[model samples]
Target: MLEKLLPIQKNLNEQPQNPDSSPEESNTSPNLLESFKDDFFESYSFVNKATLILKLFILILPGVFFFMLALNDALDRKIMALEDDKNVLTDELFVYPDVQAIHTSVVLREQILKQVNEKEHYAPAMLDSIIKSLPEGVSIKNEMVQGKTASLILLSPGPLNVASFITNVLKDDFAQEVSILSANLVMTQNIYEIELVVRYR
Candidate 1:
């Protein structure tokens, strides 16, 4: 048996190797697959990506929890401040009327009215009363009120009678100091017009 195997091995070793044989016919396909194996592993590697995502989530979770806690604490403090303010306002409401701030507006209005009555240079009310007391057919041409002085122009049909009328008005008890500004004769209407100014004491 050893002698027969020796001859068979010697005959296998004596076979000639062909240098012109194509690599594709030999072991070409497996060599290409071996080179691409490293690239395939690099292209489809999910473990590193999964580990990176897990690390990012770990970093963000603490920040999210911290933000939530801080926001809740801030809202609690704000609510506490609002409750304190509400309690203070509720307590002040009962004692507000006795604080001397009430009735100040009424007192101020009374003071203003008193001051207006005491002032010497206010005669609009008196002038209105005087206008209402004038007799018929006695139309006033001009009426002016300034400070405490009231002036008016009296027009009548009888010419040159305005001066006498003014003199009579000055002697009346209701009339104060009177001054005749002018007495003129209008020829077209044949009337006597006189301007008189009266002062209210």
Candidate 2:
């Protein structure tokens, strides 16, 4: 066996050692540029992804703060405007011309008071005297007595008798004076109606 292996060993020793064939020698040599290309690409891809993330974070920061400030300012302005509008409306409510509830109440009270006062304006004794003095065939249409004078309208049959009666009444001591204010002659069914005004005590 030893004698048979000697020839193979001698042949192995005769083979030449190529310097570029070793793995360590190939790594140390800088001429093989394709070997490191995958590592460079992986490192560049990682760095690009990181840079993109950082830029996105920086861009979003100011936008978030600016939005918050804008919302706050809008709310402040809205609140101030509402307050001013409320104040203006409150002030205007007082001076508005159509708000007449108080004035209407006062006017109603005045009208009622005036009606009540007018009902009680006459003296009782004077009213009694005028009612007692109404004569037959000489009906008074209206009478307004004040102080010592009594003004009245007398209805008579004719103008001649009314004139004579007026003259006679004026001569009496109780009569003060006589002056006719209005006269109207109405004729119907053979009857003459005369309206005359007379002044008396």
Candidate 3:
């Protein structure tokens, strides 16, 4: 009986697994799934693209944040510099400590110029006053003011009229010193020419 069973097992072991089958053709489900996976997913798949985009975001966000911080720092520095410059300019233009400094020649020069301009601007009134004060047959030829001094050239019919004019100038509060620069007769015009310079009071 052992001999019969041994021969039967030997026969079973010697038989082929399948007569018309091969290893390559086995498990069609697993092979088809592997092939489908290879075709659907390539080198640049959705998973790879998502990872690349995430890496780029991680790199660029820090760079942008640092860049904005640096820009804000630069703007703050610029604003501080501007404030310093503004303070310096304000001190130079508006701050005055000493009375003498305010009355310095440069400052006085501007004031004097402004005063003289104002005086000249009211020249019509001055001329009107002069015309009203003039004696008969006495007329002013030229008149001008230089700082605190005023000059007048007048034509009169006689010396008495010139004397009258000098008395009128002295009576007024406009002059402190009256100087007779020239007093002469114009023979052709039959008139007396008088040039006077007066210091303002």
What is residue 136's positional error in candidate 1, in angstroms?
5.6
- Could you estimate the TM-score for every candidate? 0.42, 0.29, 0.38
Worst 10 residues of 1 by lDDT: 22-31
**Most accurate candidate by TM-score:** 1
Candidate 1 structure quality by residue, lDDT tens digits, 1-201: 688888756744543365576554344332566444444436646667777889999999999999999999999999999999999998988777665655787788899999988867556565655565555556789888887778889887763355445555565565678787887789898777877887766
The 0-to-1 C-alpha lDDT of every candidate, in the order given, reads: 0.71, 0.64, 0.76
- After superposition on all C-alphas, the RMSD of every candidate to the true structure, in Å, is 10.9, 17.2, 15.1
Selected candidate, larger lDDT, 2 vs 3: 3
Clashes of 2: 0
Residue range 1-201, candidate 3, lDDT tens digits: 688788757755654566676644443343456544444346568778888999999999999999999999999999999999999997887656575675797788999899977763434544454566688889889989656667899999998998877777667676577788998899999998999886655
Residue ranges of candidate 2 with Cα displaced over 4 Å: 1-42, 96-201
* Higher-lDDT candidate of 1 and 3: 3
lDDT at 47 for candidate 2? 84
